[model samples]
Target chain A: MINAVGREIPDEILRMTGKEPFQGNSYKEGVPFRRYAPIIRPVMDNTHNKMVKDIHEALVKCKAHNGMTVSFHHHFREGDLVVCMVMEEIHKMGLKNITLAATSLGKAHDALVPMIEDGTITSIQASGVRGKIGEAISHGKLKNLAIMRSHGGRVRSLVTGETKVDIAFIGAPTADEYGNLRGVGGKSNCGVLSYSHVDGDCAEYVVAITDTLVPFPNFPAHISMTKVDCVCVVDAIGIPEKIATGAAKPTTDQRKLMMAEYCTQVVVNTPYFKDGFSYQTGVGGASIASTISLTKIMEERGIKMGFGVGGMTKPMCDLLDRGLCRVLLDTQAFDLDAVTNILNPKHHRITAGSYANPFNKGAFVNKLDYVILASLEVDVHFNCNVVVGSDGIITGAQGGHPDTAQGAKCTIVICPLLQGRIPAICSEVTTVTTPGESVDIVVTDYGVAVNPNRPDLLKALEEADCVPLKTIEQLRDEAYAITGVPNPVEFGDRIVGIIEARDGTIMDVVREIKD
Target chain B: MEILKPAVAGTLESSDCMVTVEPGQGKVNLDLDSSVMRQFGPQIKKVIAETLARLDVTDVNIRVVDKGALDCTIKARVEAAVYRSNDIRKDIPWGGAIK
Candidate 1:
C-alpha cells in the first residue's frame, strides 16, 4: 500500500509521470482468486455415456472427500439452477466449509444462504453478489469476506493461481458425451460460455450439468470433452424466459437522453470516431443511447467502428447490423435483446475475464479506444461513486463500472446534473469507484467536464463547438448554487462494508450513518 | 474432410472468411468483415466451440459463415460442426438445468 500522500511512486509510472506524495483514495488491481488455465489433462474421463455423466464424475472425483472449493458459471444469468442443485446434493451429503468461487454470485444461488448458516459453506468469492444474497451478506450474516472481482480480474486470479477451484459445475443449453456444449435452447439461453470455458480449463475437476442431453455428439460446444470429466443430467436446467427478465433495465428519462446526446458529442469530438476504432459502453440508458446516437453519427460520416464491448443491448445490436461497430465482445448479457442476439450465430462473444479484466492475458476492454459509463455521483475532482450514496447508504453496487473506466483509453462518465432535488455534482463523492486519474470526462445534460489531467481532451472538445465545457469544480458549485446547499450527511464509526478494488485491496469502507 | 453447411444463405454460411494460421496449427483465423463479424464475435465463438466438440473434429480447420449471431450463437454453431463431423446426434438439450 504505497501511501497516496505518504511516499514515492512505482518506477514504471513514476518514470513516465514522476512520483509524488499521494493524498487521494486510489486503487490498484490485486491478486486474483483463480489461476490461469494452461493446457492440462482431464483428471477423469467419461466421454462415452454423455456430457452430463462426464460432468458429474469429474465433480465427484475432484472433491473426492468433500469439504472443498467448487465453482459455477452464471452464463444462464437468472435462468440458472445448476449451482443450487449441485449444492443440494453436496448439502445432502453433509459436506461442510465448502467455498463457492463463482464468476459472479447471483440470487438464483440464494439456497446457499442455508448452507452458509448450517456451516456447510463458510466463504464466497466472485465477480459480484446481487439480490437476496447481496442483502444477506451485507447485513454481516456471512462469516467470510465476500471478495468481488471484475470479469477480467477473476480470470487473472484463476490463471495466476490465486484462486483454485477443486471442482467446477458447468451447465449448457445442450451437450454430448464428448463434452460438447452450447447455449441456444430450452426456457432461456443465448449467453456466453466464456465463464465455464475458463472454469473448466482451470479447475482440477470439471462437472458438466445440463437439462438438454443431446445425442452422441452434442454438436457445437464450448467446454471441450477432453477438459471435462463426467456429465450430470437433470430434467431441465434453466428457468425458462428468465434469460429475458434476469437483467436490470434502463430508465426512460428525458434528462438521461439529453446527457447521452452530450456524451455522443464528446465522442464525435474525441479521438474515437475513426473508421476502425474500438469502444465499450455500460448498460446505463445514457451510455446505451450515447452508443445509439454515436452509431448514427458513424453512419452519417460513413465511419465504421472496429469493435464494441458490452453485456450488450438492442442498441448495440442495431449498430452491428448497420455496419457501425465490427464486433461485440460479450461477457454478460445485460438485457433481453442481448440474450436474443446471443442465441443467434452471428454476434461476436467473448469470456468475462477476456472481456473486462486487466489481469487476463489479453482482455478486450484493455484495447478499447473509448468507454462510456455511469455513476451515482461524481466529485469535483472526477472521483466517482457507484457503490454508496450521499446519505451513507449502500444503495448502489459496483458492477463493471470501475474496471471499464480504468481499462479504456478514454473513459467518459455520463449522468444528470441533479437527481431530483439532490445535486449529482459534489465536492467529494461518497465513495470512489474509478479514481479521478482514470476518469477523462463527465458528460451531464447541461454540459461536459474534463478531468484536470486531460488537457488534450479539453482542447479537442473546445475546438469542436459541441457542448458547454467547464471544470468539475465549477459544475459542482453551479449545481449546489442551483439546488441550495445539501444537508450534510451524519456518519458514525461503525463500518458496514468495504468496497474492493479490482486487485483485491480495500479501497474504502462504507461507514454507518449516524442518525 | 467434413464441411457443415448453414441452414440459411448469406446467413451463417456467408459469414465464412479465411483461416490463415501462422505458427499455431490448431488456431482459426480470418480477415473477417469487421462490421459484421465484430458484432457477432461472441455468438459465433459459442457455436463453433460446441460444434467442434460434437463433430469430434479436433486439430482441424474451422471456417465460419456468420450473419450477425450474438456472441453466444457463434460458439454454438462451431460446436455443432464438431458434433456433425463425428456423426453424433445433434438432438440434445443446450439449455440450462432447472432447480
Candidate 2:
C-alpha cells in the first residue's frame, strides 16, 4: 500500500507487523485505546532487598531468558557502557533469540554486532541504530526485521502494548540502595533521564544500574523508587566527558550562516514568531547558527520565547539563562553546559511520553510554534530523511524529528543543497522519516521553499518578502543541476527494517542494500 | 599515454577522490569504492572510463576511492594519476586530454 507520503509499504510487511499504512498525519486523531499494563510484582514485605551485587545477578534475578525483550536508554550516548555491559553478560549466559530494545543505539554499542550474528540477539527495536549495528542489520545478519520508531512512536508502542519489554535496564548516573535514581551528582552526569521514564513505568522489571551509590534517600529522583525493582552498582556507567561534550559553538561556514539567516527570516516573518512562542532546534552547525541568528532577532524585537524543548543544547540553555526564554523542557542534554544548566529552577526535565508521545493528552511538541531541524535529504515532496544516507545505509537517528515536525505550527528543515557531490534535495528521499505534510518549510543554502500544503505560511513569507523563497521542486532541480541526478540505490528483496510513524503506522520499509 | 609505474593523485577528503593507476594485462581495469557509491557509482565509473578512453590508456589498472567527488574532479584525478604514472611533468595538456 502506498503511504500518505507516496512510499509503498509492502503488503507482506503490513500483514506481518499487523500495522496500517500511514494514511496521513491526522489519521489517528481522536483515536482511543486502553493503556497496556505490565505484570507488576508488588513489594509489600519490608524484608526484601533491592540491591544486587552485579549485572549477572540482576539478570538472573530478572529471569533473563531466551527470546525475552530487554530495554535500555541512550542517555549516555557515545560514552554509554551499560548496553554493552548488560549484553555481554547476557551473551555469556548463553541466551539466544533475545530482543534488544533501546531508546537509541550508536557507535558505542557496535560490540553487539557479534551478538546479532551469533543469534544471541535475533530481533532489535529502537528509535534508530548507527555504526556497525546498522550495517549488520542492513546486511541482513539479524534473524528478524528491525523496527525503527520515532521518539514518540517508541512510547506509543509501549503504551499500546504493541511492544512488551520484559526487562528494562536503566543506567542511572546516581542511585540509592532502594533504587531512587538521579541524573546528576555523579561522575557521569547526563542532565536528564527523560527517555527512560517510559521504560521504567512500562517494563515488567526495571533495574537501576549506577556508578555512584548515593545515600539511602537519593532524594529528588528522576526515576523514583516506586518504579524500580532492583539496583546494581557498577564501577563506571559512562565517561562523563563523552556523555556530554563541549558546547556547540555557532558555525563560521558562510553557507550555513546564509541558511541560518534565511531560516531566521522565515521564523520572524511567520505568524508564530510573536512573544511566548515555543521553539526547538537540533545541534547541527547550521541549526546552532539558526538559533544564534534567531536569538539576535528575538533580542532586537523583545520577543521572549515561551519555552524551548528537545535535546537541550548550550545555545538553547543560554536562552533560558539570559531570560530570553521562559522555560527549557529538556529531554536530553547535548553538552556539559546543558547538564550544568539543569540546576536552574526553570530548566525542567520531561518524560519521553510527555515530550512527544502522540497518544498522550498533550505533549510539549504539540505546543511548539517553531522547530528548526537538520536533514540528510529532502525530496521535492518536502519529505525529510534523517535516518538513511545516500549510500542506502541507516546512519542516523530519527530522534524527535518526525514528532516535532508534525507537532509544531511551522516546521523548518535546514539542509545544504548538496552534501559533497551528492544532492541533498532529490526527487525522492532514500527514506521518508518525516512526511511532507508535517514539514512546512525547507531552508537550503541555495534558497527556502514552503510546503504547498501550507499556503498560509507561503503567503505570509511572500508578503514579508524578506527571504528568498522557491518551490520545493525548484530546489530539487537546482540541486540536480549541480550534482547530476543520481541512480536509485539497488536493494534486495529482504526487508531489513520498518520505519514507523509517531502514530504507530508503517511509513516506510528499509530493504537490504545490495552488496 | 602509456603506463609506466604506480602513481596516485588526490586525497581522501570530502568532495575529493583518490585515483591510483598501474600497469594492467592488455585491458582497462577499474575498481571503485565510494562513500556515495550506491547513488553515483555508475556515474563515477563512466567518468573515469571516459577519461581513460580520451587519454588512450588501454592497458592500465585503475582504482578510485571516492569521497563523493564530482564528475569533473573524478576526470581530473584520473588524468593526474595517468600523467604521473608516465612521469610526465612538463608541457602537460591542460584543456586537451586533461579536460
Candidate 3:
C-alpha cells in the first residue's frame, strides 16, 4: 500500500512499526538523489546588475512543458506575490499543463484563473483553496481532482516523492543573500516556516524570491540558504492587510452564541474541571463561540486554562495572549490572525508530527486535558462524521478531527442539532472522522448528551441541573423533527482517493460517484 | 439563562473572594492575603481533587489562590483547571462524579 519513488518500503518499517511514520527518516540514511548542478547564486547585492542577469538565465534554463509540477508556500498567506508573478512569467513563456503543488493555497493566488483558463496550470494539491480560485475549482473547471492535504500531509507528500516539484518557488518573508529566512524579522511576519523547509530539502531547484533582503545571515532563520538556488528580488512580496484578516473573525450569530453556551457548560461540569487543565476547540463558528464563552466563564469563576489544542484561531489566540491558556499546541493555524500571532512568540506554531501524529513517541494530543470539535453529523450509535453529510458528498475536510479526538481527556462535539435542511444527528454518519469511543459529550443549543460511559458527568450534571442529558437517539430525533432525515446517497466504487492514517494504512476510500 | 459555570482545582483570593489558577501541578496549597478569603484556598482544592479523583486521572498539576468565591465559582474554576492540565481522556474507567 506504500511506495516511494518506485521503491517499496521494507515491511519492517511499514508493518512492524504500529505508527505509520509520516515524516521521512530525515535522520536515517535513505536513497539520496544524484545531483544535477545548476547555476545558483543568492542575490546579496540586489543593487548589482548581475543578480537580475542570473534570474533571467535561470528562467531560460527551466523552460516549462505540459504536466510539469511547480510548488510554492503560503508563508505570507494572502500577502504572496511570487506564485502569480511566476505564473505570469510561465504564461509569457507559453507553458501549459502545469500543476501547482503548493503547501497551502491562499487568497493571493486568485489571479490563477486567467492562467488556469489559458492552460498555464492544470491541477492542485494542498491544504485548501479560497476566494475566486476556490470557486473556480469547486465548479470542476479543472480536468483532475483538487487533491486536498493537511499541513503535515503536504510535507510528507513532497518528501516521499509521491508529488515531485520540478521547481520550488519560495518567496521569503525575510531572507539574506545566502538564503537564510525568518518571518518574525521581516515586515510581513507570518510565523512557521515548516512548509518551505520540506520543499527546499526535496525539490530539484528552489528559487528564493524576496522583498526584504536582510544581511547574508538573517536572524532567526527558518530555512537555511544552502537549499535555495537562484535569488530574485521583487518590488514587494505581498500586501499585508489582505492576508491578515481572511479567516480571523468569528461568527457572532445569536444561535451560535446559544450553542457555545451549552458547550462551555460541558467543560464547566466535566471531571477535567480544574486550574491548568488543557483543551482544544475548532475554528468553526460554533466551537469558537464556545471558546469565547468558556473564556468568559473561566474569567468569571477565576480560572485559567492550561493549554489549547488542534487547529488554532484568533479567539483562541486571544486566550493564549491573555494568559488564559499557557501554550497553544498548534498543528495548523486555521486563520489569518493565527498566522500573524504565530509570528509573535505569544503563540507557537508546531509541525504536524509534533501536534497530531499518533505514531510519534510523545505527541501533545496525548497530554490534552480536553478536546472540543465541530461535526457534520452524529448518529444514535454515537459515531461522528466530519467529511461527508447525509448526501455523502464531501462537505468537510479532515483537518485534525480524528487525531486529537483519539487522544484528549474529555472530547466533546459541539454542533447544532440541525443545519440548513439536513439533520445534524442521523441514523449513521456519512463519514467517520472520529470514532465515538474517545468522545465524551455532545452539546447542542437545546441540550447536552454525556456519553453513557461517562455516567458520573451525567449524575453530577443531573444534580447541577446542567443542560439536560438525552440519549443520542433523542438528539437525532429532535433534529429530524426540525428537518426530516435525508435518504442515504448512492455511490459508485471507483475509489477517487484514499484517506490513510499517519501510519499509511488505508482508513477509508472515497469513491467518485457520478456527478 | 442560569448558565452553569464549572469550578475546577485552583487557589483562593481573599479581597474579591475570587479563585485564581496558575499553571503547574494539579494541586497547590491555596494561599490568600485577604482576610475574607482566608477560609478558602487549600480547603476547596483538596475537596475538589478528592471529588474528581474518583474518576480516572493520568496526571494533574495546578496552583490556586482564592477569596470568598461561591461554590459555583469554585466548581467552574476547578473544571477549567482539570480540562487544561492532562489529556489522557479516553474510555475513563468512570468519569461523572461530584464531591
DockQ numbers for every candidate? 0.01, 0.79, 0.01
Which of 2 and 3 is the better model by lDDT? 2
Arrange candidates by lDDT, descending: 2, 1, 3
- What lDDT score is found at residue A115 in candidate 3? 78
Which of 1 and 2 is the better model by TM-score? 2
Q: After best superposition, candidate 1 residue A380: deviation in angstroms?
A: 2.9
Top-TM-score structure, candidate number: 2
Model 2 per-residue lDDT tens digits across residues A1-515 = 89888988999999999999999999999999999989889999998899999999999999889899999999999999999999999999999999999999999999999999999999999889999999998899989989999999999999998899999999999999999999999999998999999888899999999999999799899999999998999999998878875466777899999998999899999998899999999888888888888888899999999999999888898899899999999999999999999999999999999999999898989999999999999998888999888888888889999999999999999999999988999999999999988999999988899889899999999999988888888988898887789999999999999999999898899999898
Residue A150 of model 1: what lDDT?
56
**Cα error, candidate 1, residue A461 (Å):** 1.1
Residue A470, candidate 1: Cα error in Å is 2.5
Residue-wise lDDT of candidate 2 within B14-90, one digit each (tens)?
99999999999999999899988878878888889889999999999999999999888888899889999989998
TM-score of chain A of each: 0.84, 0.99, 0.75
Q: State in Å the error of residue B34, model 2.
A: 1.8
Give lDDT per model, in order. Answer: 0.65, 0.92, 0.62
- When sorted by TM-score, best at the front, the candidate numbers are 2, 1, 3
Query: Which stretches of model 1 miss by more than 4 angstroms?
Result: A1-61, A64-67, A246-252, A342-346, A389-397, A420-423, A478-498, A504-506, A509-515, B1-99
- What are the C-alpha RMSDs, in order, of all predicted structures? 23.9, 1.6, 20.3
